[model samples]
Target: MGRYACVVRPSISLVVPVFNEEENLAHAVAVAGRALAEFTSQYEVILVDDASTDRTPEIIRGLTATDPHIRTLRHDRNQKLGGTLRDGFAAASMDLVLYMDADLPFDPREIGRAISAMEVTRADMIAAYRYDRTGEGLRRAIYSYVYNGIIGVLFGWPHRDINFAFKLMRREILEAVELRSEGSLISAELITKTKNLGFTVQQIGLDYFPRTRGRSTLSSLGVIGKIFRELIVLYPEMRHPRRRSPQPAVRPAEDRAPI
Candidate 1:
């Protein structure tokens, strides 16, 4: 930890949530280690195992034993992606927080770009955008329309790829927003909240990869139906001031602009 302090830029905490991703867990972790290695001189990787039912936890143990920068946190039972991310966020010890997928859907190397974007641009959050994606072609297309349209039109968030799990957030923004969704939609919620809070956001292009194993949780019709319901009922919860325990800390912006 001491050695990392000198070189790690803003102390990065990489939070990856896992649930039954044992097959790809090790690969994701390995890529994260390599990417973060080039990302900065110092950093810590936190693997949040959300009660995996396979060898995921065992693999995590092995990973921790070999890498000092890697550590594992376990959830007794399945907490779902949202819960896993919340747990990871709570356990993060770095000033800059990164949340990514355990399925290796995005290029880990883009992490360096995100870190650089934040440091150089003075932005509080960097959201990664995907050019081409995977999964059932129709389903991914539907997801794009639902998420991007809703957040852009209703919430007015300056976000392009709301479904992307890869994000770099400053500690201040992390502490400010209370993430409550136990599923994937929380990704969109975070973008909406940050924009509503008037935080500066930057989007960067990222490589999208196909998932070889395991299946996505939602179908095209299934996701569209769910998000629409969430749109009406969840807006309040997402923007809830009471939900964020201490409330979002303000940095006294020199000028407020539309997000």
Candidate 2:
């Protein structure tokens, strides 16, 4: 009888978008690296620096030089979270692609569970919802409730956390969706579009923690207003009666390669 070997079939590419997150970059990289190591043998971490006017780019470059599994992309100007994520997704080359905040609000270890769910349920995407959101301010809490409600009402998908950063999905799903939001509403846009495109989604609960380093950009009223405006403008185009069918964007094969 021949001995059988278990091969790790699914590799992961994790994207961490950093904007003025110099303080958290090292810790985030370490924790995320350890988490990825626990699950897969083949993985890469792509750090996207969105033109931060701080030492973020320098730190990312140092980390990338030290770790061959770590790669980076930089924007000439601050493009916000949406643009960073788009760039990271486009540069990912693996069976699975995952992204989360550089602040490490959610535990990176939960990534293993997400990967397991993806394999078991065969879901196209798995998003993490914050179970304990007390660390976030009351106003932010209220905004999240209202925003999620609005998304549910408008898009008809009752996802718990539309803006949570811990999203894991197959590479094909990223290839299938044409994401355009360049602001805070990118998370909502991604989830909404994924559902509209007939992709299966799974949600898991994870604990949330307050950032120990830099200030959060999410609590501002300006951001809330922008999200409202985006929702209003995108509602009509996204509400087509027959939009449940998949409408994947076509792109050149080389465009999907990692940078």
Which candidate number has the best lDDT? 2
- Native-referenced Cα lDDT, model 2: 0.79
Whole-model lDDT, model 1: 0.74
How high is the lDDT of residue 242 in model 2?
30
Per-residue lDDT tens digits of candidate 2, residues 75-150?
9988877788999999999878988889998878787777767766667789989997777778778888988898
lDDT (0 to 1) per candidate: 0.74, 0.79
Clashing pairs in 1: 8-42
Q: State the weakest 10-residue window (summed lDDT) of model 1.
A: 1-10
Once fitted onto the true fold, the runs of candidate 1 whose alpha carbons sit more than 4 angstroms away are 1-8, 134-136, 218-230, 237-243, 247-259
lDDT tens per residue, model 1, 43-140: 78888888878888888888898889987889998766667888888888776789888888887777766766776667889888887765548766
